[model samples]
Target: MAGRQPRRTRIGDAVVVLGVACGLALVGVSGCGRSGAATGGGGGGTTAGEVAAAVREAADALVDAGSSKARTSMEMATGGTRVTIRGEGVYDYRKRIGRLKVLLPQDPSGAPVSRPITELLAPGALFMKNRGAGVPANKWVRVDTGTLPDGNLVTGGVTDPFTAAELLRGARTATYVGRTEFAGVPVRHYRGTADLHEAAQAASEANRRTLGAAASEFATSEVPFDVYLDDQGRIRKVRHRFSFVNEERSAPVAVASTTLLHDFGAPVDVRLPEAEDIYAGRIAKE
Candidate 1:
């Protein structure tokens, strides 16, 4: 017992296991084509107001489109180590629900360390199977998104698609980077910063509390993002940079989360687990 780590410390460390393991480098994407560039107030005949308005309206546009197939990547860096987690699924924007198969990185030896986790994203809750550690293989662990320090944004290893789009509603300052082609589709690129508190204020009732919690707990409330929108104003892709305090080292951890949506009108069917199948016991820390 002399050299044993306390339970609290172990749990705190486990909280970031998915975020801190060594893994592949974050992928970089480049855009093709260019129209005009603008920054701040106005340039190239584009106004800051216009850019902000377009970015802010993206979420509503997604909802109107109905549903889409999505891919997500979250890269976290801390203490000089970086890791990436990737997920793919379909989301029904109108229903505010989705299902994703999240894949954790393999070990240093290239051996699979864990099975893919099945995650269900609902308005205010997150449900997961193969959650690792103490959770039974057949039972799902359910978490209230609003109770997480990062509002489940960075905690669950992948940002919820709806929440990611809603964050754009807080866009305060934006610049039209130029016109570009994303995944072979023509789109307008924009770079901007969003205030978490402002986003929470503009968010739907189900998301307000979660975003509010993130606003108060993250290292800073201002989130920097790059967004790509098609002619219909739907978000083709979005990437957000967030920072949060790491409880173990008392330092800030940098996180970069990317979401890509395609095939609008795609069918999505997500059913939450039954109450009896949810895990209610204390989770063990690895």
Candidate 2:
């Protein structure tokens, strides 16, 4: 928390995971950002061309701020299903199960892959899906809001919106990747990456010179960026893939939060089991 900015106490869903131990966090955002906009669209005087760049810039800052926290928000549409993901947390050290809160459309009710999806939060790839009904409702594991699979991506949901906006800000110069319609919205896609080599050099200089300079360099550390803006002039989709440069090894991942709350006005409590319960063949982290 020494160098981190004061984060917003978000409700509903935000991609923000705070890694308390390593002092790193991640943030993600949904397609429809909580920009405090009304349901009616096209009121803003800004065009897609003018605002796209700035939006991505805002998203990049959000990601950098959230990486220390281990959180993110990704908007994915598959097979007529619109998934607004607010993800935070990773389980294993090598990146295993991640935590997620999926906001699904209710009118159609449950679909095949209707439950929340978890991905790898540690510096690796991990995603699991329960295709069949073998898994029953209420059987899903419950965990704290700011906690991850093994406690990796906590508070990721809250941070995602900002990250998406920042990435879009940088994407403006990544060559106009053109536009497409996704989920009934016109999307403008742009791609770009952070200069890892330069980032490493700057880090080295800061270390050899002034610690304050090193701290500043780390704050502006670059990472890859991607974005897709919707027709309503909002972020419809985003996938900001970032990798740390000149890292001796992958950084450690941890989860931290003041508390976790749910949409139905409920709370998620993550606690350790008793010794007797462990002996009774009950072991699960939620």
Candidate 3:
């Protein structure tokens, strides 16, 4: 195993599988600026069609290293630091079954550090695989849905915008908007929304240790998402908005900011936790 690439690590529903086997893809996107040009259906990509095209081209077009992407605009907060963010990622979808590396670049003032993070968004079931520098490698070595490993507590499984769109099969329902250029390439735009209730429930249950303390029972609302696609039907941007109709502003902190998606993939270590049996009982095809 010394020379072999690490197998995947599963944490609840997500799996992080990595091996030298998959083809690597890498591309740089010239992110749009202030006009809201940086996200799924916002300021840039001059035309909705252009935004869609960028997604299609990247999803369909395989690079020698992998494909790259960025998130729609998102408000990010951790500890006491808050920043508006547009996360970016690269992946070899053709290889390793969508192996991906996502990064949040340095802020405009270069005051905050940019993080290059790696994660796998499984084709189904909201499963994920992830890794990043400075983070405890053990977190990625296996499935761990504890608090944010990086201490950046923005709870979300589809942290990357495009993946959120792709998971819902946005290509099928997305309506064409217009066109614009991203990273010097033309992109087509599209939109769609699907429920993340199931994933959310799973996450809440997986982290039951913390959520269990809530004094009141909870009901989840339907999640509405804004999505974007390219010409070839590849997802470019995703915007997920969760509304809690039952809870008030006084609800648990996690109810407002945490996410539930966890890792699902091949096992990286030979020694399995006693909890492995629990995962084995899960309905998994990957």
lDDT of each: 0.74, 0.30, 0.30
**Ranking of candidates on lDDT, top first:** 1, 2, 3
- Stretches of candidate 2 exceeding 4 Å from the true structure: 1-159, 170-172, 193-220, 245-286
Model 3 is weakest, by summed lDDT over 10 consecutive residues, at 19-28
Off by over 4 Å in 1: 1-45, 109-111
How would you encode candidate 1's per-residue C-alpha lDDT over 1-286 as one tens digit per residue? 1011112222244355333254211000111112223222223234766676677777877887899999999887755867778999999988999999998866656776588889999989988898776788999998888777667777677889989988888877788899889999878888888878888888877688888877776545678899988877788999998654444655555668999999999999899999999999976544
In order of appearance, the predictions have TM-scores of 0.84, 0.32, 0.38
Q: Candidate 2 residues 1-286, lDDT tens each?
A: 1112111222112121221112222122322243422112432224454443334333222222232223344332333444444545422111112243432223234444344543222122112222112333223322232222211112332222222232233232343466666556656654554332232232212111221222133333344455554433344455544212212223321112211111211122323323332222222211
CA RMSD of all predictions:
8.3, 15.3, 15.3
TM-score of 3: 0.38
Q: Model 2 TM-score?
A: 0.32
Candidate with maximal TM-score: 1
Best by lDDT: 1
Model with the higher TM-score, candidate 2 or 3: 3
